[model samples]
Target: MKEKIKKACAIWNPIAGNVRRNEKNIDLAIDFFKQKGYEIVKKATVGPLTATQIARDAAYNGAEYIIAIGGDGTINEVLNGMHDTNAILGIVPMGTANLLARQINIPTNTVKALKSLDNVDIQEVSLGKANDRYFILMTGIGFDGYIISKITSNLKTKYGKLAFAYHATIESFLYSYPVFSMKINGRELTSAFAIVALSKEYGGLFSLTPKANLQSEQFQVCIFHKRGPFTFWKYFISALFRMHDKLPDVTLEYADTIEVYSEEKVWSQIDGELFTQLPVKISIVPKGLKLLVPRTAKHSFPTYKESR
Candidate 1:
């Protein structure tokens, strides 16, 4: 543990709203690590894919631990940069809805989270590979993707939680259903919406795929075939209640891989960033990412039974 803690890279996204507001918090985190006798190389990502390039360079320079100091989107970029490397990953989770960090029970308090890293229990989490890029959370298409497209950084910075709701409201009025072609575990179907998830949670708190596990090799792909204003509410309710599979218009499949296409070009978003457009091929890489989680933390799961 001491050897692994010697040299580390702190990959920071200075422009991330949460991080930007809590600059002093992160500075204390840096000081705390330095006090613990770790040689920390601070790298701030300037723009798009900057986090990835910085992480790749840090890894190449023999950084044993790559610590992410931004949101899940930042972590996603770092994962793509790692690309099959055997380096341990750590997280400080300074972002809107740090789903990955929350899943592993890492507190959002920058200093506390960094201190927890010393006693981390390393675990292997699954990675969703699209084309060649990696996504730490779920991949979205259709209405949700369109909603993401509507969210601007300025709006997110101004409104916070209401930003998504506002963007969704606008999207609901202006956007029509997207025509999708999907292949799940060999069967082909056309749908208006699709979500292929590697983690159990979506949109921070929603348990869209409650039974899904990040450490598991399988991916849960939920497809909604219905189109209309009510269709969004129906699916949204199911996701809100963690009953996505039971939605009347929804079909759920568990497979190692899935492919998605569309008659017209449809945009896709992964871990909050606008990703490649369809036709996309998504595959689950079992135990691909080595994540540093709290020693006492458990993977996020659904509370179905009264007693565990």
Candidate 2:
């Protein structure tokens, strides 16, 4: 009459954000899972892409649940290493901008996020792939990507989310806006900046793509036609007011695949992590990832015929 114990692996990033605080929270998470009869295994990442390697090993070893204790970048890495496994993904949100956690209604507070694991509400979600890489949230080219590329590790460690804002301000004045040709599901379009988003939220708080839903096998592509200081300010203000979609120069469309090319080299970002240069292909992977969410969370995407 006793329940079976589940194997749970925690991939902790000790230097993600607020190192001391994150370490304490990770300790609490381990204790909580152990109390719930989970056979807990811990792995601490020391450098870039370490979480991905650790996650792959855990999945191959038959871990029932793999929890990432960092930001969106860490979660993205773990997802990439997960392969087509049965392990469910969980988030602890220990970074400056936990956009993935926010989009899925996961608690930003580390303790609360850990406690939500008790619900065991597992769901299969779609993911966006840029080239060979998989992104759980969104990807960007031009302005947003340039800003992320400029934000160094030292700045992030010292100023946290403020680092993004700082670089964005400086880049807005100096960055030369480059034009890119985008083919969205075969429809050709040109834009100065583009964001292919799978979630409604951006930077943890702002809702740049209000119609985006992670559970659906579709992406909300936002294209900005103009690129200048004034234009950027206008877009920023519109985003703050949640009316960017109404702007004349801004276009929002839904697509299952997108291909982008640039005459000149431009940066690209995936899930807040700096990725490769321009000339990339992006597509949606249907029901690609199994994620753990709160039982009470409301999904924006329409329900499928079968629930996982």
lDDT of each: 0.78, 0.84
lDDT of 1 at 78: 87
lDDT of 2 by residue, 207-245 (tens): 877888888778998998898888888988988888889
The candidate 2 region of ten consecutive residues with least summed lDDT is 299-308
Model 2, position 230: C-alpha lDDT score: 80
Q: Give the TM-score of candidate 2.
A: 0.95
Candidate 1 structure quality by residue, lDDT tens digits, 159-270 = 6657888877667656778788888777888898888887777777587776677766888877788887777777778778778777667888788878889878688889
Among residues 3 or more apart in sequence or in different chains, the pairs in candidate 1 whose N, CA or C atoms overlap within 3 Å are none
Lowest-scoring 10 consecutive residues by lDDT in candidate 1? Answer: 299-308
Angstrom error of the Cα, residue 189, model 2: value is 0.8
After superposition, which runs of candidate 2 have C-alpha atoms over 4 Å from their true positions?
299-301, 304-308
Q: List CA RMSD, all candidates.
A: 4.0, 1.8
Question: In every candidate, how many clashes are there?
Answer: 0, 0
